[model samples]
Target: MGIFGFFILAAAGYFLYRNYFTTNTYETKDERYNAARAQRQKELDGLLDKINRRGMSSLSERERQRLDELSGK
Candidate 1:
């Protein structure tokens, strides 16, 4: 019974620590949005470069779908 109580207390403490003490990678909504936009643009550029070098046929089905998504098709 004592060991079980200790385990419950430790679990609750861990939950509180994780929920209240963890720091987010981005500090604000605008910063997070900009970072995501930059990453998407970088990926789009790489995909376009691949197509330019190897032709659109070289893109796998997944890559083609990703291109459509990034280009807002």
Candidate 2:
């Protein structure tokens, strides 16, 4: 092969090696976060159910605190 062809092949090989070895670790973390979010949403849904049945005023102080803690606000 000519010098140019040899360099082209070398670059291609290097790119292939990099592409093969790169880690995609974010997907696993994103899945965990999605699961936690879904669980939190379910908990909030339950709380809303309580509110619907018992009225918002019926929420105890502890329940309000718990809601605030979960909401981080």
Candidate 3:
């Protein structure tokens, strides 16, 4: 029973290490930058659309700050 429990713990540790510590080897720096830029653009577009539908006053302070940050203010 002791050896069985040790093996179980070792397997769980290895699974956690593999999931959290391992980095993706296929993603290059440029790829990561492009992905981030695209995501920012998507968020900016959504915020702009919301403003058009409702109004600037509908945005929360955090959302306004995020919009400014994404827009490079």
Candidate 4:
């Protein structure tokens, strides 16, 4: 290829790589909050399952407090 053609191909490749391979992490405050809430929900579900199988008495004090805090009580 000619020099001009080579530079054109290089620029196109650079732009394509930047668009498709770069990480996008531009979360708004609400989006970040929702993601955190989802994670907490997953954790709470696991804890609740443990309580169901083993009874509430099986939960450590820290785990029970976390449950109360998460349940908004």
**Winning model by TM-score:** 4
Best-performing candidate as measured by lDDT? 1
lDDT of 4: 0.93
lDDT of 1 by residue, 1-61 (tens): 6999999999999998887778554469888889999999999999999999999999999
Stretches of model 4 off by over 4 angstroms after superposition: 1-21
Once model 1 is optimally superposed onto the true structure by TM-score, how far is the C-alpha of residue 41 displaced, in angstroms?
Answer: 0.3
Residue-level lDDT for 70 in candidate 4: 86
Off by over 4 Å in 2: 1-27
lDDT per residue for candidate 4 within 10-37, as digits (tens), equals 9999998898789586789999999999
Q: Order the candidates by TM-score, highest first — what do you get?
A: 4, 1, 3, 2
Question: By TM-score, how accurate is candidate 2?
Answer: 0.53
Residue lDDT tens for model 2, 1-73: 9999999999998997777767554568889999999999888888878989999898999988877877778
lDDT of each: 0.94, 0.85, 0.93, 0.93
Error of 2 at 29 (Å): 0.2
Model 3 agreement with the true structure over 1-53: per-residue lDDT tens digits: 69999999999999988987895568899999999999999999999999999
Model 2 root-mean-square deviation: 10.3
